[model samples]
Target: MTESAPTPQPDGLDVYVITYDEEGHEERLLPSEVTDAVVERSRDFGINKGSWTIDRIKHGPLIAAESQLRLVNVGSLARAIAGNYYGTALIVDQTPPPIDEDVYDIDRRYDVDVVDDVLVAVVTQRHPAQPAETEAEIAARLARIAAAYGCRIVGVSFALPGGGTPEEMLSHWPEGEEWSERFRAETIETLAGMAHDVKVSIATDDNVTMATLMDGAAAMADYLSATQTGPLDAAGVLNLLRGGHFNLLIGEAESGYLEVKTQMHPISAPGDTGKKAKVELAQDVARFANGDVDAVLVIGYKEAPGGANTIGSLTPVADSILNTAQIHELLDARIVPPVDGLIIEKFVVTATDSVLAIYVPKQPSEMQPYLVHGAIAEGKVEGAFFSIVRRRGEGSITTSAQQIHAYIVAGKRYLRGND
Candidate 1:
């Protein structure tokens, strides 16, 4: 027996979103809607989309600490904008009380969701900050409103320009000693920290990001003392870490799960040039629903202020638990991995009296993607797949059946396509 050298097969994909541009132009800034969808997918499938992806949903929730309200609100807006894909945005600041209908209308027009307490603003597809709203004003206003509304907010995620280097951002820094040089470097690190907090929260427990906030003073000191260029440089460093740059795993256990091995890197959200690190770790648990592995485990890491060459902040580990309860809700298949390009088959099975003929791919590779697309399009899983239902006086039964007429009709079309 012999062991083979490990070849690099991307452990998994990091599907991030890029902004849209004119028909033949480069995509620079993603709209808010697209970002929302990406976020939703990340939550559902463990993938990272732009800074904030998952615009499909009305509003994405971001929990911030009391002391950090100003930046958190700004981040919420940033997330909404980056995810929208279309030039529409809706931002709601829950702390305030007057329901802003105009804002809601704007968000609805562009299919973006921004709902907070009473301050909701819906922005339609348009050039970002067309009338010239400076990032500082926005941040300060949000901070003021949050205070008035009695909500303490902090922590932010989603995408922003690398180091918040846009004109508006640069204009806002206060008069001090050589701020320009420092501003460029510090903003990137700040944004990275914000993104890191968001990732840590979603991937692990909610309180984990908060706990780190308690150590803010110490964290700030360490970060200030570090010799690194800033978060942007840290991102490059993280990539180096990814490349066999370091050879060790670090982290602690989740609330009630076994500790898993981990790795951390500062990878930016898709399309954003910021220096936020994308933390990846390996988990010991396997997610098998019915004697079959469905998901691969990866640990996420975030950088602690000035902590370098050490476990920065340990984001709580998500219990490597499989969503087995919803197994019945999924369209089961025995398809080849999508990367392999195998065929899929559609069929059904029988248990008690009822029969369910599922729409399975004749070729394995075709099945999974088809199911995913169908689920996205139709909300309900269609085609030939196993489903559990509680029938009248029949208790719960897993049944299979065949619709010969419809099946034949669709099958003919399927054959035609293949032919």
Candidate 2:
């Protein structure tokens, strides 16, 4: 038989051995020839408990490894070669690794892993920290970090002890209030505009592991990207609350775009009493319709002593009193030149306590001066026909003769396209 040249042995591969000590010190071994003996020795050198858990064996340019081996059972071979020192190994190869590849496969194959391709940035908040940072500040910092890494934020999750429900965890805040819930909701809302995926999770233990958080974030990012479209839903509102933006409604004064109501007119039954309450609701809507910008009417928050608005008792409107349908019907029926973009939502704080938020969007300039058609109060002249304009820092004031003149002048300027 003709003598055949022995199959050329593949180029030597580089094997790196990394070890970690109990003191958390890391030592990386020099690159050595890839051989069963060298790999076995490396495993022996990196066999400490800490190294076994923390050290990762990574390999790349897998073409050389494949050329050298007859049958490349990458994962098993790597673990067997490393022996007891086998930790997490990553294989870097142009070809995709098997779907069942383990962390040890990092050393055995070259493939693109979703975990590696998608960078996860985690921003953590710990309780009992001094001089707490505001949600805005925290969000800004996270944004900058994500930008630096060119990665999208996946979600916002809370790490709490015992991993209780959001409500249960929030109860730990002072007075067992829902400040934590609101904070979480608000943070989610703020991040929602930036990243599609946002969520909240309670840690199973006191220790919040980055690995667990990254997993959750990845899942949430996938979900948000796949399922959600347009703006956020009720969950988004909760996120808004958690973000602390609701504090704006509770602060010292209401802006022209904001209104706070301690309570709504009680609705006993669907009769004259209910009609009166509906008409009253319409009046509030009309007031905002005439304003220059969108308005937010927050019911259940009342002005307390020292001008601070506090969340008031929710006894005014019974749980069965107003549904979304009734609120919409009332607005459609009572307000003349019906306001567009009015969103009425009810937020239940507790079993016996709840609040209603009426969002009134600004109407066109021609639609200004919206008037309440049916008067709730029979004798009061003010209730029959009125144009209420919100003055900054000042409470809602009825349109005065001077103000009307200014409105006419402004209207003329807008119409003529000149001041």
C-alpha RMSD by candidate, in order: 27.5, 21.5
Can you write out model 1's per-residue Cα lDDT over 108-157, one digit (the tens) per residue? 22111233321232212222222223434433433422332223233222
- lDDT, model 1: 0.26
- Lowest lDDT 10-residue stretch of candidate 2: 197-206
**In model 2, which regions exceed 4 Å deviation?**
1-253, 267-276, 309-317, 351-353, 374-394, 401-419
Poorly placed runs, candidate 1 (over 4 Å): 1-127, 131-408, 414-419
Best by lDDT: 2
Give the per-residue lDDT of model 2 (tens digit) for 75-94.
22233233334432322222
Q: Which candidate ranks first by TM-score, i.e. highest?
A: 2
User: Each model's C-alpha lDDT?
Assistant: 0.26, 0.45
